[model samples]
Target: MRIGYFLSSEEYTPAELIEQAKGAERAGFSALWISDHYHPWVDAQGQSAFVWSIIGALSQATTLPITTAVTCPTVRIHPAVIAQAAATSAVLTGGTFRLGVGTGEALNEHIFGDAWPEAEIRLDMLEEAIHIMRELWKGGVVSHHGKHYTVENARVYTLPEQPIEVLISGFGPKAVDLAARIGEGFVSVAPDAEMVQRFRSGGGNSRTCQGGFKAAFATSEEEGARIAYEKWPNAGVPGELSQVLPSPKHFEQASQLVTQDMVKKAFVCGNDPEAHLAMIDTYAKAGFDEIYVANSGPHYQGLFDMYAHSVLPKL
Candidate 1:
């Protein structure tokens, strides 16, 4: 399995983010996965830059391949526009970019005053969006009409040497099957083995699969839990339900239910080298083509340093 790095979009400044990307590449990570967000889920998570711009910056900063952990092409931005952006980015990055996409949430999508689409509608949108993007990248005029969208003749001018690979983010069975049928790669963060199996059964090939686990690392486990709750209260599962609920306060409220112990189980926390190495191994055993880990709390450099100096050496 290849080791990869994941960055929380809100966690660092653009310059810091670029530096971190370089650090990870130097540390020998095979690739980089960065979150795409327009707004921080809460005031606490704190910064969201235009992810495409950041992807461009990282392309210059490091050689590590970059992927949007998942970007919603159908909602905030038209797939045609995203197609141009992805194509240009891949060409600039020397074909080092992968278009990791998913049906997004109200947080980013609602910005355009567009109604938040339901799961079924989102999936439908995703299918059509993928079609639009792929065709545009083929380097000629293309137009598309589908249940959720219609495009006039459009073509991306600056294309990449290689066609970009599309990775679909999926969680449940229906989503998994769709990813299998359409996506070149499957992306997930949940530790569930069944999700991977379902993804494969649903038509997901023996292609690249990327999965991540998060941890709140600190000197004290109590401090770790506090940080975990602050950053991500909803730790156990993944989906859009938590997003549509009622308020940002609800996420903070739900976060209160998550304990440090729960976060620890999900991620190998603390300064222990063995613990971190084991966490990496667990994902490898789960058949992940790439395993990504992100630090939930501060001590970002510590975690990166640990991973590079000790854990990466061992791996």
Candidate 2:
């Protein structure tokens, strides 16, 4: 499988993200996955740079393809605006940019005080938003008056030679079906073979399926686990909490029940290249076309170096 690096916007500054992009390129990573978040999961994680600004800077920093691990174009921003931003991004990246989108989480989208829609309603909005974006990308004036959104004679002026590909992120059966029906590709953070098969059977056959996992690279496993827990305790918050929680404080409150061991189990904690490879292999065996690994601690350079020498060379 193609190995890529995931840039966590929630944890790193724009400069750090750009630096990581260059490092990933130099380290021989094939592509990039950058998260689009308005807030850090918790106070400890800290930074949340505007993803578009980082993407623009990344265009100048590296030649590797970049995808928004998932951008929500439904609530915080209008689809028309996202279309323009994504179009400019695709042009800036020399057409190597893909727009990865999903229904988004309340933690990011509830900032406007809008009532958080249920999963089904959010999915409906996402489908309409995608339609609007695709229409705008066709390079003509588009006026859409749909159930969830309205566009009045708006058009995306600066577009790439080809329309940007939309990769949908899905973690459940309904979302996966929507992705198969509309997305050019699929995106996920899990190595679930069942979901991959469901997407293919539902109509995503032959489409690219990309997956990602988090790692905490340090001198040893225990140290890595400590860093992961300190920065990403929310990783252990089970069920729909991730989707429904409205703020970092809310997540922190819910994360109180999460133990360091729970967080460690979710990430490949340590400097062991073999462990990293095993995690990557899980995604590969589950039929992913590409897999991305994201580092949770300050030792991202260490992680990159390990991948460049011990991990990537073997792959």
Candidate 3:
């Protein structure tokens, strides 16, 4: 039941993110989760700093253990390159970093004009990418010609004292099985007991299971919901749309139908400490090893104070 702060890279500047990292540590969070995004989910979110650069800054900014909420290693960037970057990040954080990875979305991967493959194909790519990364992390030159990727004479010269742990993020059964087979841990946004059971049944019982949620802790519920709706209505866009949407503009257009009421239902808006606690309890009860929460608006300090004074202590 460890509680952590989630840094939303899409909404904050790099400097502000570093400050938030430090602030989170100071406010009694046990760890950190940072989203890795090349583009914002919607244009309203307004920012997307390079995640690796932020990781480098975070390694120096806070002692709190950090995880990239998830990074996609299969497309836009080659697996070998991501392996090198992740290895360097592990070293930079003194082994406090865990690499959380996934199959990725069109929003980020489509930038290089690569055709977004079907979900099944993407999973295959992710598995191969993981294998390539693990080999490079073992500290030797490696070469591979796989179905979806080719790595030639790749080696990571600098790595952490400990081997970096890789966590797989997924929501469905097939993906969960893949995580159990290869991942050192698992990650998800929702607290699904069945998913956790599937992981354990597939031999991931001993691995870390992490989840994340959002909160908009403003002075009033209406104000919180309004901000959340304005900034994150895309979150309510259901189904595979999140994975396949090609641009923020498309997302914004789709999210036009998401009302403030939808945001209110999805997020724990307002300054109610009890509501915040209840949201966290859902994840804790689901047996997550770690849970992280991100603010949906500019009032992060208020959220921190609420957690520090009221919410975190109860958990």
Candidate 4:
């Protein structure tokens, strides 16, 4: 399995981001998936840096490939803007960047006072946006008027060595099917055998799977849970409900009903080396070509070391 690291945009500043990216590369991680959220989920999470700039800096910081875990092009930013941004990033990275995109969240998309579109509409918008981006990326003057976007007489001057790959992310079956038809790759938080199968059945290649999971590591399990529930109480929202509840408070409220046992089932929360490796293996077994670990809380350096000694050697 190819191993990668998922960085919380809120958690790291540019210098810290570079240090972590370099560390992951040295530690033998294959690639990096950074998030692009305009707002931190909530202040509990503390920060969400503008992602495009970070990708630009990371191009210089490391040689490992980078992909946005998912950026929403339909709502706040036009696809034309995202196309130009992705093209520029690909050039800066010398063709190592992939633009991973998705139908986004109300939390991020609604911040600009635009109502979040329904899932079906968002999917439609994404398809149209992808069409627009592709035309713009071909390095020629383009005129496009899609149902969701328009661009006229535009061309990317700083061309990439190649076109940026588009990776799509989605959790549900319909969305997964949509990705399979349109994406060069697919990304998801949890690896499910059925979801992988569904993607394959719907047109995604067997080789095009990437999965990520969060693991909490602290000196104390108590410290880890405290941090976990404090920063990500909404995490326990299972299945489709994560689609409806729109605020951090909803997560906090739903989380109050979540037990430590429940949280345990969802993440690796202790410092055990064997335990961490086991957590990573579960996703690999489910058919992920790439497995990304989202390091939890703080103490990132130690978490990386622990994984290197115990978790990584096993993988």
Best by TM-score: 2
Instruction: Put down candidate 3 lDDT per residue, 56-112, tens digits, no spaces.
Output: 999988999899889999998898999999989888888989999999999999998
Residue-wise lDDT of candidate 1 within 255-274, one digit each (tens)?
Answer: 66666566556665667778
Candidate 1 Cα outliers beyond 4 Å, as residue runs:
236-240, 246-250, 256-260
Q: Name the candidate, 1 or 3, with the larger lDDT value.
A: 3
Maximum-lDDT candidate: 2
Off by over 4 Å in 3: none
Clashes of 2: 0
lDDT of 4: 0.80
lDDT of 2 by residue, 104-168 (tens): 99999999899999999999999999999999999999998899999998988999998799999
- For each candidate in turn, the TM-score is 0.93, 0.99, 0.98, 0.93
Clashing pairs in 1: 180-203, 180-204, 233-255
* Model 4 TM-score, all chains together: 0.93
What lDDT score is found at residue 226 in candidate 1? Answer: 73
lDDT of all predictions: 0.80, 0.95, 0.91, 0.80
* Ranked candidates, highest TM-score first: 2, 3, 4, 1
Model 4 lDDT tens row, 1-315? 788998888666777878888888877778999988876555677778889999988998899889898898988798989999999999888898988999988767776677767899999999999988888888889898777777888887777978788989888887788888988888888869888888877898764788888777888767776666666665676765555456666656666777766666677676777776776778878878888887757777877887677677777
